[model samples]
Structures are given as structure tokens and as C-alpha cells.
Target: MTEDLTGKRALVTGAASGIGAATARWLAAHGVTALVLVDLDGPGLAALDMPCEVLPFPGDVTDEALWDRIEAEAGPLDYAVINAGIAGGAPIATMTLDEWRATLSVNLDGAFLALRCATRLVRDHGAMVLTASVSGLKAEPGTAAYGASKAGLMQLGRVAAKELAPRGVRVNCIAPGGVDTPIWDQTPFFQEMIAQAGGDRAAAMAALSGAATPLARFATADQIAAQIGFLLSDAAGTITGTSLVSDGGYLL
Candidate 1:
């Protein structure tokens, strides 16, 4: 068990699914009291049962006005985890402008907006963590847009830490490789991932189990969540403006 964030409040974008959802639950385990959960998943957030006083807001994180409204309503928080994202894989020549914008808007721009707003509403020395990805560190032929956006998020966290430091706040980023999240069930990459296992998801998943990565296998969302919970807690008081990669060794 970590330090209980009993009196602290929090806001997590993309709180209804995957790493976002895992983090919210992990914080609850450490005794969080208030959570303002934001995501397009209305019913999903509503369905969550936790001790925290959860306020679900359905909206896009890319809108500046959305953050303004969230800050006005959610009050001060102790931590903010920016974890929403999309996977767009296309060569630059074939990718449409709208596709590029969409990726940047949600993955990069959205994170920036949430961080900016959280900066205003968190306690002076509060903490913030952004979810970047292993893709940010490695670029592939078809994943240029997604990779660039995440790379941008990593940089954003550094700049945010610099801006928020004097104010007593800290900022950091998480770059996860692959996590066994439901989104994999919906993305085309899952098929490619499956093919890598010789036309079997289970087998391909096993193959992805990391002959290359030091940790081996895909990261479970819970695994990523634990790190997030740590950063938000007092345990990480001296840490900021850096990245915590949770790819189970995909980058190693």
C-alpha cells in the first residue's frame, strides 16, 4: 500500500478504459477521496463502483473550453493523469490531413489541454502524469502519426514541469509499450499482432511475450497503473519532468 491520498481530488481524462481506468482504480486502492472522471464513455464511468466521489463528464479533451469548464467545476486536485489516446498508422504520403489532425488533437493536443487546466486547479505542489507510449521512442513505417504525437507528449511533460516547478508542481510522462487492453480487440494492429504469432492471437500474443523486452510479455494495465499511483503519491516527491516507460521491455 502507498500513501493514502485521502483528502486529495483528481481528474483523469480517458478514465473509462484501459490504462486510464486502471489508474483510477489503483488510486482508489490507495484511498483517494474525490475523482472527476472525464471521457467519452458516459455509461462506462457511471458504471464504475469505487469509494471516490466520481463526477463523470462526457466530452473531448482537445477543446480548451472543456478544460476551463472542468477546472471551474472540479475544484482543486492533487493529481491529474492524461491518458486518452488513439492509434493511427499510415504512411505520411497516404495519410489524409484530417487523419493527422485527429491523431494530434487527441493524443498530443488533448494531453496539453488537460495538463494546462490541471495546473490551474491542482494544489500548488500537486503532481501530474501524462501517458505517452513506447511508440514515442521508436518510429515505425506505418505509425508515424501516432509516434510523433506521443513523442510530442513526452516533450510537453518536460516543458510543463519547467513551467510548473516554480509553482511547486511536478509533471512527468509514461511511455508504455503494449498493454493487454480492450482497445487491442478493436484496433487493426491487433490483427498484425496476431499475424506475428502465426495467425493466432493467443500465440502471437505469446510471441510478443518479449524475447526482446527485458520484462517479457505485454504489460497489463494494472502494471502501468501501479507506477501512476506511485507518481501521484508522496513517494515520488523528488521525481518530475521525466518519463516512466512501462512496455515490459519492448524498448529494451
Candidate 2:
């Protein structure tokens, strides 16, 4: 049975696109009445046409003032998806201090801010899902900054879960391997790969996913969104402080 979220309200970071946007649409389709969508992409936020009430907040997640404004204005929420993040990668030796700090600022510190605000605004029995990445769990040469940040987020989710348990709130992480998301477009490596494939992004994605993933394909944003929805639902009431890795067997 599909869990109904009628009259529910939610906060979705990174909601302008990819998994965040998909989750927002999924929640609306499942009967959520309202959503407060946060993202750095103002145009992207404005472009979304969800069935429910959508309050789009455009700003950087790393900005504490932005989150503070949200807490003051968005009011109560039943669910929170702390999914705003960026893609950054470089070998430890070559990666600049600026690069390292940038990744941590958005993926880890930004999550902290969002979680803090959500804990204040979200009701007891509410749930939160952080969008961590498989890079955090399994190390790669160039992924130090990205991996460390996501690793921190995973730990943050666990700690938050423990701390919020007494209040009947649950926290979890979704560590996706490589679902096709616009976040990839931000990386120069992927852009070069696309160029190699004669600008066919799908071909580039297929080549990469086919090589690394046992499933031979990357997941779609909608697929990941469904998982997030399940995690936020009553069906996942007993699950907390854990990560649901949706990597298409890439870890293997």
C-alpha cells in the first residue's frame, strides 16, 4: 500500500532539480499539501510546477542567514530532505585549500545548518534524509574532498538519529552511487567525457555506468526520489540512523 501524506508539509533542499525536484513532485503526487523548496538556482526553483503549494527559497545552503530566514518563515514541516550539494574532486596533493573548503561548506556544513533548522521546525515523528554519496563510503583517488564531506554527512545523520530518537524523529542518509543528475554537469570530468562521446550525454553516462556498475546503468532521479519517499513514510518507521545505498552495485 502506498503511504498517504495528505495534509503533510515538507522542506526540500536542492529542490530545483534532480533528486530534490523529483522528491518534491513525488510528495505532491502522494498528497503532500505544501513544500518549502530551497536551492541556489532561482530560475530553476521558479520553473517547478508542483501540484501543492510551493514556497521557493533561492540562496546558497552554506549561508546560515538563509537557513535562519527559512526557519522563521517556513513554519512547521513534517519532512525534510537536506539534499543541496555540489560535486568537487581532485587528488589530495593537487586539490587546493579553497576547493576542499568549498566541498565541505556545502555538503557537510550546509547539511548541518539545514538539519538544525529542521529539528526546530519539524514535528516529532518527522523524518529527514540527507543526500550523501557513495564516494564517502568507498574512497577513490580524486574524491578526497567530496568523500570526506559526505562521510561527515553520514555520521551527522547517524548522530542526529540518535539525538532525535527520544523525540521520535528519525534521520537517515541516501548514499547514491551515480544516478543521472544535473550535478554531474558541474564537473569538468563529466563534461570532457560528454565531449568525447560527441556531446551525447546519455552515451557518456552509459559508458561510465556500464563500466563501474554491475547493473550496467545509472539510476534516474525519480527512482531515488521514490526511495526518499519511502524513507520519509510510516513504512520506514523502524528504520533510522542508517544509510540506504542505491548504487546499482557500484560498491562491488
Candidate 3:
């Protein structure tokens, strides 16, 4: 059956780019009436020309005060996609305490804050999706901080799903593998890795995708967003407390 979002109100964090931005556009295409988009990139948010009523909120998702303002002004939300996150980290031996904390603050803590507020504000039967990573499920060298943060987010989603089930608010996590998103370009570790590969980021990405992913390619942000859109729709009403792995068989 086809999914429809006509006249529905939704909230999307990290909507300035990547999966969040794609999800917002997908929702608009599906006929959502109002979109409350939150992102730290003010200029990026302003550049988005969605067809719906766009309430662009430029702020940190980790800020409790920001969420308060969002809840007060955005009105009742029918869906939420908590996709704001940072990537890149060092090995445990080289990683500093501050680096670890910073990763957790944005990935785990930010997710917790968004989930807390979403549970309170989302109408009954509404759904939410958290952006996690394949690293959360499988270990990789030099990703101690990033992996731990996403793993925590995975557990958090499961627990929140159970707690919110009575209220009919479904909570699920989306763990994606390497996607050609701006986040990769902004990640220091990834940039350094690419530099090591003859300074060709595309070549490095292709090599990595060929070696690691069974599908031999990276998933697109819109592909991941499509899954997020599904979880938020009535078509996935029976799905909750589950982790949807869209990793092109990276975990396998």
C-alpha cells in the first residue's frame, strides 16, 4: 500500500543536510502540511525550499532550552526524525577524554534529549526514528568514541520504545553504513584517510565501499531517508523497538 502524509505535521533534526534533509524533502513530496526543521547550519536551513510550511529552527539539538522553544512553537507533531550527529574519532589509546565526551554529547545525549521531548509532544500513534550507525553494531579500529556513542543510542531507542509503547508512540533506530553525505566530507578522520589515498576522496570512498560493503557501493542519503519515512508512516505501525540496518550488508 502507498503511504501518505497529507496534512501531517513533522519535525526533523539535522535537516540542513544529509539524511535529515532528504527526509524533510520526502515528507514534503508525500504532502505533509507542516515541517519543523532543526539544524545548527542556519544558512543551510535557509537554503532549503520545501513545498510545505517550513519552520526552520537553527540550533543545537543537545540544548534543552532549544527543545523547549521548539515544543512551544512547533505545535503538535505527528512524526520526528532525530538524525543530528557527528562522525570521526580516534583510537582509545590516542583519544582524549574531551573527544570521547564530545562524541557522546552530540550523538547519545542529543538523541536522548530529542527522544524525551518527542515522547511528550508527539501525538499518540505517532512514530520517531533515530539515526544510528553500523559502527554501533560492529566494531572497527580507530572508532572507539563514535562507535560507543551510536551503540548507546541503539540501546536508548529500544528502551524508549518500550516506555512509550503504552502511549502508542513507536520508537525505532536506523543504523546506516557509509553514505555519501556531507558529514563524511566534514569528518577529519575521513578526510585524513582520503588524503592518504592519493588525495582523491572519491577513489578512497570507492575502494572502501568495494572492500567492506557486500553491495559494493555506498547508500545515498535519500535511500536512508526512505527507510526513515517508512518507519514514520502507518505502513510500519507494527514496528517499534527495532533497529533497521541499512548498511548494504556491511555487518554481514
Candidate 4:
């Protein structure tokens, strides 16, 4: 059943591209009227042309002051997608402190700031979804920093769920295994894979997904966005604190 978001308002971080942009579009299509989009990519955020009211805030999510302004300016929201994050990996032995901090600063700290604002401004009965990763649940080599950050995010969402329960606010985590998103190109690992696949991004992603997942395919941005939408909708009214892992059998 289609979730009717008519007259609802939402805040989506990392709205410039990837899962964030997909989620924004999803919400807009589902009848959300006002969407507050936050992303560092100003042009990308501005490029999104949706039917709803799009309020773009181009800034780093880690900036507390930026979040402060958003809290003061953006009105109360019915939903929040705390999804701004970066991807990187290295063996713990080789990962520098700077690399570790950089990942956590965005994936964890930035998420915390967004959550703080959402928890405060979101109306009672509103829902929020945090983007985590399968890496957080299943350990793998060279994913120390990224995995740790996502693990922290998962825990944070659970705690927020408990604290906000009294207010009728629902918080959950979406831990996707592999999805076709722009975040992959930002990482050297996937770039190398793309190059090796004769510059065909699709081929590379397919190869990776086939190797990693029992389903032999990765999800699309829209698929992940739909899952997030489900979690944020009234259909999930009784669900909170749990994680919906959309991993294509990767966990198995």
C-alpha cells in the first residue's frame, strides 16, 4: 500500500545524491509537501527539481552551528532521514588516526548532530531513519573505520528510539549491504574495480555484488529509499529501535 504523506514535512541529510536524493524524491512523490534538504554539494542539492517545497541547506553535517541554524529556521518535521555519510576502508594496521577520525566525524558525529535536531523538532509520532551499513554488523577485513562508525550509528539509533518512545517518536536504522550509489565512486577501491572492469561501472558493481551477496546483485538507490520510506510510514508505527537490514542475504 502506498503511504500517504500528504501535508507532511521531512528533513533529509546528504540530499545531494545517492540514497539521500532518492529518499527525498521518494518522499516528494508520496505527497510530502515540505522537504528540508541538507548537503555539502550545493549545486547537486539545488539541481533536485521536485514537486514539493525544497529548502536546500548546503553545509557540512558535522558543523554544529549549521545544525543549530537548521533547528531554528526549519519548522517542525514529521520525518527525518539522517543519512549524510562517507565511505572508506583500510586495514586497521595501516589506517591512520586522521582517516579514522574523518570517517567518524561524518558518519557518526554528523549523524548525532542531525539526530539531536530531529529529536527536538520532529513532532510526536514522527519517525526517523539512520543509514547504517552491513559492515557494522558483520566484520570484514579493511573496514575498521567505516564499520565502527556505522556500528556506533546503529547503537545511537537504538538509544534514541528508547528515549523518544515516550514522545511517540520512532527511530530505526537501515543497514544496506551494497547499493548502486555515488558513494562508491568516491572510494579508491571501487574506482580501481571500475577501471579493472573496463570502465563499466555497472559491470564492476555487478561483479562485486555477485561476489559478496548470495542474491548476486546489489540494490538500487530507489530500493533502499523505499525500505526507508516503509520504516518511516504509519505502517511501521509499532516498530522502533530495530534495524531493517536490506543486505541481499549478505549476512548469511
Better of 1 and 2 by lDDT: 2
Worst 10 residues of 3 by lDDT: 184-193
lDDT by residue for model 1 (102-142), tens? 99999988988888888888889899999998899987688
Candidate 1 ranges with C-alpha deviation above 4 Å: 192-201, 210-214
Local lDDT at 22 for model 3: 97
Q: Tell how far residue 84 is off in model 3, in angstroms.
A: 0.2
Off by over 4 Å in 2: none
Q: How far is 232's C-alpha from truth in model 1 (Å)?
A: 1.5
- Comparing 2 with 3 on TM-score, the higher-scoring candidate is 2
- lDDT tens readout by residue for model 3, 1-252: 268889799989999999999999999999999999999999999999998899999999889999899878888888989999998768799889998988899999888888887777899888999999999999998889899999999999999899989989999999999898988887777687799998998898888788879999999998998989898888889999999999988988
Q: To one decimal, what is the Cα RMSD in angstroms of model 3 from the true structure?
A: 1.4
Q: After superposition, how far is residue 104 of candidate 4 from its true place, in Å?
A: 0.2
Question: Which one wins on lDDT?
Answer: 4
lDDT of 4 by residue, 107-170 (tens): 9999999999998899999999999999999999999999999999999999999999999999
Q: Each model's TM-score?
A: 0.92, 0.98, 0.96, 0.99
lDDT of 2: 0.94
Question: Which pairs clash inside model 1?
Answer: 177-247, 197-204, 209-217, 213-249
**CA lDDT scores, all candidates in order:** 0.85, 0.94, 0.90, 0.96
Q: RMSD, each candidate, Å?
A: 2.0, 0.8, 1.4, 0.7
